[model samples]
Target: MAVAATPSAPIFVVADDHPMVRDALALSLGAAFPGAQVEFAGSLGETLMAVERRPDADLVILDLDMPGMNGMAGLAQLRSSHASVPVAIVSAARSPALMRQAVEMGAAGFIPKFTPSQEITDAIRDILAGAVWLPEVARDHQLAPVEADLALRAAQLTPQQHRVLALMAQGKPNKVIAFEMQITEPTVKSHVTEILRRLGVQSRTQAVIVAQKLGMEPPAAKGS
Candidate 1:
């Protein structure tokens, strides 16, 4: 396999809610890139803020089910806000479908949480060297056309529109969305309208279904 040029002492941001997972990733990253700096975040909001603070971060390893992630929507949000930074999804859910979806949504890599430490380090190395990494099991898995189309439509949403869509998926009404987003009710309604139009869905319920399609509902057997 071809490897991109590697950066020495690269900065990495590891975002996962579980302290143990964060520490394990930190250990792997620190060992792999000696003198590297590793930052931690327990939620999507924090991850975005952390990345915003360090736009030059070489890589970001994110947890899909973390607080404020709203599934792949958070990935879309991060990609939209900081398209330059390479973000990898490191999660317990290892379904090939979810892995393909993450890549479809622009992840640099999808590392299953149970990955061995040395392999994790190697994957991070590959990602830093400008390669897209995925578990061996996901290599030959093809994304369904409908799944790919959903990813494409989801990617079309502006970051704010993504936030509105996430709230709508949670069954939040426009008034509540307005209060949470600190915007006027009419603004929220406008966002909802745009979300519906962008997703090619006519009604809020249909939009919610689209959101759920991009949501974090991995199989019950796939523990998050």
Candidate 2:
């Protein structure tokens, strides 16, 4: 029988806006996965770019509340663009519902920001070994069919369209989205039309409702 090969030094991207949290996780990862290559990002855009630059990275530890995330929308974008790279959610939110939702959305693991460094390391190791990791609080979870379908649709969006839809989900008008995204209003309108089509929704209201399925109010966490 042949033995499978494993990476001797794993590469990781830790994406969090807070410098302290990002540094702390890097330290923990370095200690746990000796000789591991760790990169950092402060927002969803930066995270996406970093992962794009390192598509062969072993893992991505993502922060759910960072800028440009707009809830789990960014996750959909990342998974859409880089299906081969594994992603893990590390958030302050300890909600079992959110954890289960992440798993259903194709996350490799869900780690609470408050989890001890050792546990986080263990979770990473397990995920890298091809196991799905979720906290104990989220063990017996199930997903609604509607939510699963929504995640699937969201993952089909192109990166730019996903960003437009995220802003739209915030109830932003086309002009506002254009200004925020530094694009023209007409372009925003085009994106909206395509977003509605991809989501199989005929109107902006229905599209927002679909976005809301993956939406979340930011959670407050200590030391995060």
Candidate 3:
């Protein structure tokens, strides 16, 4: 779905430690939405400063593992300081616990660090439309309350893809996943690719993030 345009362009804030990653994300957003404005922050201090300077950001894409101030802590602070601005967790950690924590902490959605550009755009659009972007399992398990449509959409994933997603969320590499599942490395690679496609993510980190948002646990090793 396309993001609805407003008379005033929506402002965005992105906080991440890696300069290249931050720039890449900004570039991707710029390409996707030509008129929108984005502000970058490399640390929590910088993020706070940017927010103070421009208290009109419509969305904040937050990284939860930054130096000095952890992502969750920063998020809490941001919420306290700017209660109205919506926040989205965009992190590398894919643990279900973390994703649950993000929602409980009042994030509008949880977007994985490796999510594809299109998925990221979709998430932003959805959030702006006042819809939460959580996975179906998370809703079913009561990890978070979500829209029925989001839950139904998540339920469409295949069982094998679900297993693959669970393993990836546990930080398992493709080779380790292959060995544990008794599948060939190439097969694992293919599954990983398919999982990313299904999740609308561009990288493993993003896929793992999405898996956690769905309330998925790590897959058991082949022999337990």
TM-score of each: 0.79, 0.72, 0.58
- As a whole number from 0 to 100, the lDDT of residue 83 in candidate 2 is 84
TM match of model 2 to true structure: 0.72
- Report the candidate with higher lDDT, 1 versus 2: 2
Question: lDDT value for candidate 2?
Answer: 0.80
lDDT tens digits by residue: candidate 3, 1-224: 12334556677888887788788877777776666788888787787887887687888888866653433445667766787888887876655445655576578988877777788887778887898876443443654443332333333444455456666777788888788768898988888888677556689887766655554444233234
**Can you write out model 1's per-residue Cα lDDT over 41-137, one digit (the tens) per residue?**
9999999989988788889999988888767768888998898999988887755656766786688999988898898889988988889999876
Of candidates 2 and 1, the better by TM-score: 1
Query: Would you list the C-alpha lDDT of every candidate in the order shown?
Result: 0.79, 0.80, 0.67
lDDT of 3: 0.67
Query: What's the lDDT for residue 129 in model 1?
Result: 86
**What residue pairs are clashing in model 1?**
none
Candidate 3 off by > 4 Å: 1-7, 135-137, 142-224
